[model samples]
Target: MTVNRFLIPAFAAALLGAFGLIAAAQAQTGPLRIEITEGVIEPLPFAVPDFVDEGGAGEYARNVARVIASDLSGTGLFREIPREAHISRVTSFDSSIAFEDWKAINAQAVITGAVTVSGDRIVVKFRLFDVFSGQQLGEGLQFAGTTQSWRRMAHKVADAAYSRITGEGGYFDTRVVFVSESGPKNNRLKRLAVMDYDGANVQYLTDSSSIVLAPRFSPTGDRILYTSYESGFPRITLMDVGSLRTQALAEQPGTMTFAPRFSPDGSRVVFSLERGGNSDLYMLDIGSGGLQQLTNAPSIETAPSFSPDGSQIVFESDRSGTQQLYIMPAGGGEGRRISGGQGRYGTPVWSPRGDMIAFTKQHQGRFHIGVMRTDGSEERLLTASFLDEGPTWAPNGRVIMFTRETSGAGGQAALYSVDISGRNLRQIPTEGAASDPAWSPLLP
Candidate 1:
């Protein structure tokens, strides 16, 4: 099966409004030439030599090199040359690189680096070479930071190399903030958990006493917005991720708020408000205590997501007697439905690329994953099954992370990823039954 990439109507309007000439020029320039398909194309081979330094940072340097190599290899797009396969060792940055040795091992790209340490500070210099073409793709770049930041520096280098080859943004240096669940479904213990993109370093930022859901990372990955039931009711909470210090947003008594998402600027959070008996979309100023109601309707209006430019919002509502997607101004205005007359669309999540919105559609007792343009056109279903919803975009927007639940037996729920082309469905490992998975933006 093939997945059809849907372009939100609002994004097309924004392109014509903001970059009319550039958009037109690109249209004339034709579609992107490179299309990744589901075939056994030879993986791009790469070699990452052990970084050496004059200072005795042996273990640290080796770990950094390992992280860089792992990040590149985990994308499923690159194959790493094993350390035992290396024929030559590079010790100095000025040493002549042996490109043939890397090519002989079927490596198309080679990454060489040197590490140095001064007190608590460390410096890392790395170069990326196109071994097949026998040319340097880019000049060597160096990073200087504290010893603890060495891992981050390695990720940065890997990201740069990945971008240079793929011609698209890289997500190696990203973090995923998700609600970690344990215990039974009836009395589950949940906490805010974060992990590296590769699931290597897992850390729980919050305890399991409180029930938290829908943890969204800010654009800078420094803060998170989530709905917590700590105060005996569902309320939006903002926390500085680096500090784990949290403060409740504007809360109303006898009301519940959920499905919160951060604005592109990270200055505000758009969420659904269930006040009295109605659900509507509201924007809360993340910095100030100001509140702006974006949707005023008796019908359910939930899952509001901001456009990348912070100008418009895509959300789901039931104004038409069935759930569907709608787009309105950031400050609230006349809304337009955009779900292509689907059965019932909910959990509409705007893609990071700002071109599409992934949503959950219920049709004939079955669930489907679909995308559509912002203005309610070109709705295309990606995946359909017994239960598949809560679609979250991979940082590059080429893939979607969602939860897949099985029926009967234990009714297991697990996280899975499907490429936008509806191929390469891979299951992401979790400690236990997991659902409502959210992907974070790439780390800066």
Candidate 2:
């Protein structure tokens, strides 16, 4: 099912007020600032008290507070001080701040909030403070939604805190679409599934009767494009996420299409089409049902992705007798070879920031997830394993999630994520084996 962006009322006003407060406070006390570019060797210590229940929010208040703390701590840039070490409690949202008490516990930052539940609705308001300077980091903001959406509200609060302190966008408010697998490794059953960025709120989009691969979300997260073998051959299918309806795009009797991705505007798709035992890159206009061939060569050209501005396209080809990366105009022209490494590269994906491209490289019997500049300079391998491929970027372009498969008789595939800086590598929790992860853009 389709997941709509969370509606946080008065967010702009809150953000403005927050930044204004931070600026005023900075002028007065000049608190310590985090320079993200320099890299964080030590995580900043912070604290979060159980949010006050304004009007009987029940257990939701505590749970929400815990989730916020978890989100911040999971980033590897913040450390959560246990509540037991607290010298002062946040009994109310408007209570006087105890900067001294927090400082005694060596807490650099603190978060305080109140949760109110009325009928099925829930509202959460929170503020961030620099304990050392005794100043508010930003203006307090409130988020309101249904009780069932409490987790999302907590994530928003964490995102705001992350952005305000680090001066960067947050990726917590996004979703990932992937192929969930089960059964034996020899005969794995794969189907399309979607989940929260943290691997929560999982929902299946297709049954296992038909094998699915490379499930990609539209730019707006309202639709999905995937390759299915329902017709006994791989064919690209467009799906309305909310309705679970599917339609074939550019369907041809003798050709197969796969590895489809939506354009930045969500009005077109780029994919690989196979005909006569040869595969090439093609683009399709969704509105006009028009098709355009982007690449024509004897070598295979596939896994095409568009830059953030939609001006250029990146793909993989073996024109030089080895799979390598190439960049060309969005409309397709004489492509310039970009990758000159000592290996085969495939699945080149442009970052959301449009600064670098993440790809899968195979060399010396090992597979790695790596990134290179748009011109194929400063290449760095972020992960190496028995098998790691399909690197998809986080909403903020600071991290990548990909599929990792084990090597053995009982080997299986699972989803994994790694920071772009080559830190915080971890596996995403899933019910079973999973692969071909596709992360959607941040919710509205």
For model 2, residues 155-259, the per-residue Cα lDDT tens digits are: 889888877766557888788999999999778899999998889889999999988999889999999999999999899999999999999888989999999
On a 0 to 1 TM-score scale, where does candidate 1 land against the true structure?
0.84
Clashing pairs in 1: 3-421, 7-373, 8-373, 8-374, 9-373, 9-374, 9-375, 338-376
TM-score of each: 0.84, 0.92
In order, candidate lDDTs are 0.76, 0.86
RMSD of each predicted structure: 6.9, 6.2
Q: For candidate 1, which ten residues in a row score worst on lDDT? A: 19-28
lDDT (10s digit) by residue, model 1, range 105-205: 86677888888888888888888777755777666888888887777788888887776665556776776777667776567777888766655567888
Top model number, TM-score: 2
Can you give the lDDT of residue 352 in candidate 1? Answer: 85
